[model samples]
Target: MTAEPILTISGLNVDYGTGANGVRALRDIDLTLHRGEVLGLAGESGSGKSTLAYAVTRLLSPPGVITGGDVHYHRPGGGEPVDILSLTPDELRAFRWQELSIVFQGAMNSLNPVHTVHSQLTDVLTAHRPGMRAAERTARAEELLTLVGISADRLAAYPHQLSGGMRQRVMIAMALALEPEIVIMDEPTTALDVVMQRQILRKLVELRERLSFSVVFITHDISLLIEFSDRIAIMYGGRIVEQAGAAEIYRDPRHPYSDGLLHSFPALHGPRRELTGIPGSPPHLSAMPTGCAFHPRCGKAFEPCAERVPALAPPDAGQDREVACWLHH
Candidate 1:
């Protein structure tokens, strides 16, 4: 991956309501997506993975508000970065599909049941490129379907007529229709069988190679992230607990939570080992614990862990890895 950053998020915070009663959904998030690289986000449910995605994309709905943060889109050739949080509604609409697109979770249900695939695909083009002729839109729609390995002949098919995998592929096709610089996929392969999941992920990697677009892939499966992503960020209790290269994290995780997560999944090639999942369930957002959020479940917690939250920083002065834990600090 290149050193140039395509997107930068710093000090991001999100809440579900206003005032002291509000639930803190995300806290002090800092992440960077480099050009032409897949950055994987892995954690258990309610780890703020989806919240981070929605916050960055400016798609968070009612009661959910971005309390503080800056999300900057670094255009090619390094001009002044666009402040994503400052865009007006009109500008945000224009910015979304053209610069960044997202394939939401449960893509199968995301599609319109009444509309045919062709109509849905062409709708994006018609809205974005109003001057384009109908014939051109049709051609582009067909091409997009073909790009995702779906035959053009299925363009007229409704969502119900298509298989689950095909519907997911159609969603991917739509996300890439405008050739955006960044694509955020929030559990795009959810509910699919393992074989189908692998097929879809492989196709995404291939498409990224051909199109040269960066991706932020979010999932609960750490194994899949380790297999496909260039780097992995592990989230827990609304904060980033660890961030490192996928192989580095797999070989040696710095955070106790990350270690537990790695051990939760079975190895396919290495010697057989027991799977001891994380000891406790994730903390409730409304009633979060004091100090470090993971301290309650962390096996290696110490005196300082419960008194103060650990900053996410590199353990060694020159290392690229970052972990939020008193053990490393």
Candidate 2:
């Protein structure tokens, strides 16, 4: 990964309602995505992983609002960074598919059931590249299908005619139609089987390498993130608990939550061992814990963990690692 940052998010805050009754979904989030690198976001359901993605893309709907944050996109080469939150509606529309695109969680739900695959793929090109001829659009659509390993003949197939994996590939094709600089994928492989998931992930890595675009890959699977991402950020109760290189996170996770997540998954190539999943359900948004959200469930929680929230900072135990836990702080 390059040292230059392509996307930077600072002091991000989000809420699900308005006024005094609002429940904060994300709190003081700060993250950076370097150019041509994949940054993986891992957390359990309702941890605000999807919320952060939607907020960054400005796709958050009603009842879900970005209360505070600054999202800046630094274009290629030297130029003024674009403030994403400040963009007008028209500018944001143009910016969406051209600069950034997203593949939502479910492919079947994302694709239009009535529309043909060819039309859906070409629609993106036609909307963004208005000057292109019909033949060119058709050619581009076929190329996109080919890029995603789908047969060109499938272009005529409707959503229901294709398999789940193919539908997901079509969604990926649409996301890449404009060749955006950044792609946010929210559990793109959640519906697929293990074999299909690996195939899709491998294809995505190949595409990222060839296209040189940055990616924000969000999922609950920490193991998958460790294998495919350049860096990993662990979130708990909407707050980032740890951020570090994939290898570093896998080998030595300083945060208790991170350690728990690592232990939750089974080892593929190691001696047989019993799985020790984290105890207790994730805290509800309305009744979040006093200080550290994970303290109630943390095996290593101490007095300080319950008294004050720990800032995500580099720990003395390692370099280039940040953990938000009193034990490390």
Candidate 3:
């Protein structure tokens, strides 16, 4: 069954620094993540996928500011939606990990080398569920490890002792400790090999099914997104150029940037074809093109594309998908 919308992002804009010299890292972005569904975010390295993830979780560091936007999270039990952007520091602390958790990029490296897996897992529960007794926390830690496919025996091992994939799974287990309604993973598999990456993602989907949490999976790999995501949103130069169902995007992408990204990866089953990557580098945020930031790199660019920026909207009539390009206009 299709789940109800869990999070809504509207007119989201992020900038680095303040003043006329500030660079726009994310354009006005509007997106919706449904409950228990996986939404894949794809783009080049500098396209602001990670920025959006951090922005949503209110985790962005110094010099980064949200110039405009509203991020709303609907309560799980049909309660009134809360404005995430407006939460106070104390409220944010209570909200995170309980309502939503994020597994950051290179998350395996984030584990404390000095602490055992058992200690770390228990720490999260200890902080959030202060009333839980020591024995209960220990049992919960072992259960969490088991949920992520890690044996309870590994609980006493330090981060350095675990393999890279195991470390990633541990991070995932920690994220799920609070049973948050949503989990945002940013390039969680970057350091793992292909086989391990596949295993981790597959296991993640299994856990999602069992736990009923939505996912915002951010990665630059379009092929990976196609295989795992229910819906895919393609971003370029910090703006989303296209968004649609994964199958619809793979079969009939409406934007040139999305098409370019799809073709950049080779298909394991389909007939062989020459692999050609998109030409020209991504636009620098400081000197982004006036109209469309992707126009210079888009092979399908034309007169109107260079003169006026196209808003993300549905193409023609009777289509649910949206694209930001003059080709459809």
Candidate 4:
């Protein structure tokens, strides 16, 4: 059964500056994250994957600005949607970790080098749950460590004391400290080895199942998403080119960019295949190509691809999927 929508992003647009000098980073992006499911967002380095995460969390700084659109969080237990964009400073602070939390890319480095793990974990609780006593906070901190498969003994240790995976798990522990309904993880396993990455993702999935919180896992690793995500959304040039069930995307990708991304990863179990990296680099937002931004590199591009933008819509197939390409239209 399809889960209820937990977060709805409508007509979302982002730009770097104001007026003509501004460069568009995101354009009319629409997405829905369902309750208790892992939604994977994947693309190349500059495809605006991180930007989308930061924008959704309102963590974008300086020149980054939300030009338009609304991000609505559908409160659990069937409450009215709360417009995140409309939140005031105090409301925004209270809304952040208590409702939506993010485990940023390279999150391990985000830990404070000087503070003990116990202190860091408790700080979140102290800030959010002011009524809790100091002893209660310490006990909860230990429990959080144990929940992430780390020993409570490490709570007193500094950030440098733990291994890479342990540190990453510590970050996960912090994000879950508040038991938020949605957790946005931006490439949570960037430098970890394959085995470690798989282990972390597996543990994350296990925790999600038990905790019942939705996840927006961002990564450039298509294969990892194929293994772990319930649904996959492929981004190209700051827009989602295709989105569908993970298996459907792997079996039959509709967009040319999606196909390219899927093929970029090496196959492990299938017959040996040569890896073909996506041709050409992504277009610069300042001088974006007319029409489809990917048309410059898309092998399937025709005259229309260069002249008109393709709206994301259902393809000829009846499957529950959406694609943005003139070829499908």
Per lDDT, the best of the predicted structures is: 1
Residue 221, candidate 4: C-alpha displacement in angstroms: 0.9
- lDDT agreement with native, every candidate: 0.95, 0.93, 0.93, 0.93
- Better candidate by lDDT, 1 or 2: 1
Q: Encode model 2's per-residue lDDT on 1-329: one tens digit a residue.
A: 78999999999999999988889999999999999999999999999999999999999988999989899999998699999999999999999989999999886468988999988999988888999999999999999999999999999999999988889989998999999999999999999999999999999999999899899999999999999999999999999999999999999988878888888989999798788889998999999999899999988888888889999999985577788888876
Model 1 steric clash total:
0
Q: Quote each prediction's TM-score.
A: 0.99, 0.98, 0.98, 0.98
lDDT of 1 by residue, 248-290 (tens): 9999999988889889988999789999889989999998888
Local lDDT at 286 for model 2: 93
lDDT of 3 by residue, 16-98 (tens): 99888799999999999998889999999999999999999999997999999999999877888999999999999999999
Over the stretch 97-156, how does candidate 4's per-residue lDDT look in tens digits? 999999989998999999999999999999999999999999999999999999999989
lDDT of model 3 at position 256:
88
Tell me the TM-score of model 1: 0.99
Q: Which stretches of candidate 1 lie over 4 Å from their true place?
A: none
Backbone atom clashes (below 3 Å) for every candidate? 0, 0, 0, 0
Give stretches of model 2 more than 4 Å off.
none
